[model samples]
Target: MDPEILKFKILVLGDSGTGKTSIVRRIIRDEFSLVHSATVGVDFSVKVLNIAQGLEIRLQLWDLAGQDRFNHLSRLYYKQASGVLLVCDETKPDSLDSIVKWKGELDARLQYKIPAVLLVNKTDLIDDEDEGFSEDDLEKICSRLRIGSWSRTSAKDGFGVNECIKALVWDILSDKESKTPDPLTKTKDVFDWDDDCSSSIIRLGRQDLDLANSRGRARKCCH
Candidate 1:
């Protein structure tokens, strides 16, 4: 049997020019671009991250467009997200304030709280230590959002890139661990699968089988 690999979908959300894409690139590619075009709809990338012990998580990172025109498309990507990184440009204080809108949208779509980390990006843009948002502001955000931690990251110089991602992954893992039940206790929602959802086992099985048959016929024709 193939080795089991845990997969988690993580969403990157922020306003335009907040460096959400740059942060993802820094984490997955370890490269930075001086000028990156604004994301249109959404971009996808995968990275294998080693967390605690020998466990590894395959992160499917989705970089959502920050433009208001594409706000309608956000739900399509966030529906399957396991965690979220709410990024903001440290230099542009306004960007930090806009995190409220991003967080609201995510909450409206998700209907339940998901593990999220607040990231202040572009720390390099600040020439002095006193230029960026104050600790009081960050504390207020954390308190209002009930966020456990926040980090300042610089996508250009690769500062705190790994740390931010690792923190998010840790939160995801911790959330999963808390949700798991002990051997003696029964699961809380065992009938979750019967929640009257359209994406049931029968539907998914038939869809997969149909696709496989279609591919098999194509292969036979090629032979």
Candidate 2:
């Protein structure tokens, strides 16, 4: 059976030092970097990801530079973006606000909202005494931004990295099924960040990816 092909432009936005590039490397290249070289302006990567049985997603992952100086350049990449991943650093709480601003900027530029998810990276440096983003904290933001889901990740260890991408892609697919709301539209406001949080992986069907590119077509929003 031929699986349906879908191509999507997914923007990865976050403040510098939040490990956006590292996460991108882990996903697109299956590698991680120890050096913290910042993304110059905008970096692009692509992967054919498996979302479900008989369904594959050609993800054009755009890793936008987090430097404030590149704000204008970053907004240019938001045009016709299918979804967004707002990466934030666990240690640097201020980055969370930046993620909010980035989301707002994306909507303002695109003239509409698309599915957005949060990836709180740097989980490998866990501090037990530190208070992380609580349910109330997430609820308020999720309600306002309409973020579909969020999860803790460690780009260094490759933990929950793939799950984060899968979650957002799944949300994009749901938005296309009908104008009516579905489970994907519902706020999955929270995900367990504990050691057992591996369960967060999207369980659309069989896992992993292998499909034809052919400029995949299912719900690509951009021309």
RMSD of each: 16.6, 10.3
lDDT of 1 by residue, 60-143 (tens): 999998888987887698887899888999888889888888888888899777887777788778777678887668767866
**Per-residue accuracy of model 2 over 101-204 as CA lDDT, tens digit each:** 88787877897678887787887786663455554565566667777766777899887777677667656766765455554322232231223323423333
State in Å the error of residue 135, model 2.
3.4
- State the displacement of the C-alpha of residue 78, model 2, in Å, after optimal TM-score superposition: 0.8
Candidate whose TM-score is highest: 1
Taking all chains together, the TM-score of candidate 2 against the true structure is 0.75
Question: What is the C-alpha local distance difference test score of each model?
Answer: 0.69, 0.69
